[model samples]
Target: MTTEPAADPQAGKSWSVEVYRFDPERSVKGHLVSYRVPRLEKMTVLDALAYIQRYHDRSLAFRYACRLGMCGTCTVMVNDIPRWACRTSIERLGGETIRITPLRFLPVLKDVLVDYAPFFAKYRAAEAYFVPGEERAEIAPISPKSRERRAIDPNLECITCGACYASCTMLAHDAEYLGPAALNRAFTLIRDSRDGARAERLAAVGGEHGCWRCHSLFNCTEVCPKHLSPTRAITGLKRSIVLDRLRSRLR
Candidate 1:
């Protein structure tokens, strides 16, 4: 629950928004700062933050880009759920008060701005990169109907917004776990026909800190704005690992 800031108890056509504020240089614990805003038709949660910034407080900080649902940068916790602020309509949430906070499981640098370094660091740890073919004199022909391409089509939508990462309970417990995004990226690479580093990519996502750490909670899938399923991708990795082991045994 958020502590409502002291304001004039005047009732009007306005909504109360609680934004989490913190300054790593000044404050050790973040606190909820409330803002009274005029309710507008089709106003989004992002719109409310902007209104607060423009008319209420310019110092209020949050991230947004594309102003549309495409960029996942504007994600925040709306009523304890991770959502894209730009696309989340205040009316849709059905509350006179909204509690907005930085995405969970990440360090907050300031108001609604969390440090993404540790989140992106896992990408490197998982080696989430597309390694080109060793002897690629020409582009490898891949069909639109190819099984490899189809297997990875659903997972290619990740914007790496860390929504899934923030929603992941596993990360709160296992610091070394690669989490969903990196493992999903690895799964795509492993399924890509043109990727030459299949074995290396597989190794990167197969161990204790890799896809094995996923608990199948599907929280990653639930919070994904693009509707991509990292859980499915992680399961694919596990299946690949098992199949590879069976092949090795047979050989």
Candidate 2:
């Protein structure tokens, strides 16, 4: 059998962790398990989980890949808010206890591992793929400085970590809802000068589970790791749709 890596002795020496535990193969309902860790400089919440898994218990379940926060797989609810544990330093938590749980809107596969199928499904339903036309060779070169392109610049940095989806109340209430991230993706395409799918994308997001469902609670914006605001993008889509409707009426 392979041995698990040892915990760093210098990590936070006097912090308590409360982990939400659920195993379909082993647990009846689910439970919160607590672990105490040693204090160290600049330790993150991911490091705390790593220490618990290696030294305190071997069966605890959580998901992580890149320890530096780029992979987006290490997102979890810390102190009841969705955040990337890899980037959340223990010292910044401002408390003696840290509570960890799976993302809110998705089904939990285990302790902190949420099923991403529903999240990705919404993404696919948004028709987020690029649509090209036969006249691609004749297409004029587009400048990034164009007003429309610049409008979508902030949205392109999304890592699709599902943190926004997890914190969205609109998605929690309506399972069929296409969430902020997906709608943001739609906005990007809609704003693109070369895209041929504007009408189709607008139709996709114009229905019940579309842009109108957003309540502007800003939860997605609050939890987003990249600081990109899908809320603003959704608002922009609403304005565009409203203007288009008015223009059609005038015609």
Question: Considering every candidate listed, which one attains the maximal lDDT?
Answer: 1
Query: Whole-model lDDT for model 2 versus the true structure?
Result: 0.86
Worst 10 residues of 1 by lDDT: 4-13
TM-score of 1: 0.92
Per-residue accuracy of model 2 over 1-251 as CA lDDT, tens digit each: 99999985644458888999998997677888888887778989999999999999888788889887688888999988889999999888888888998988889988888988988888678777678643655756667888877889888877788889889887768989999989988888888877788777787888889899999989898889999999999998898888888999999
- Model 1 C-alpha lDDT per residue in residues 93-200, reported as the tens digit of each score: 887899999998877878998888888888888888888867778778778788877878889978878888888999888888998988889888888767788787
Error of 2 at 192 (Å): 0.8
TM-score of each: 0.92, 0.89
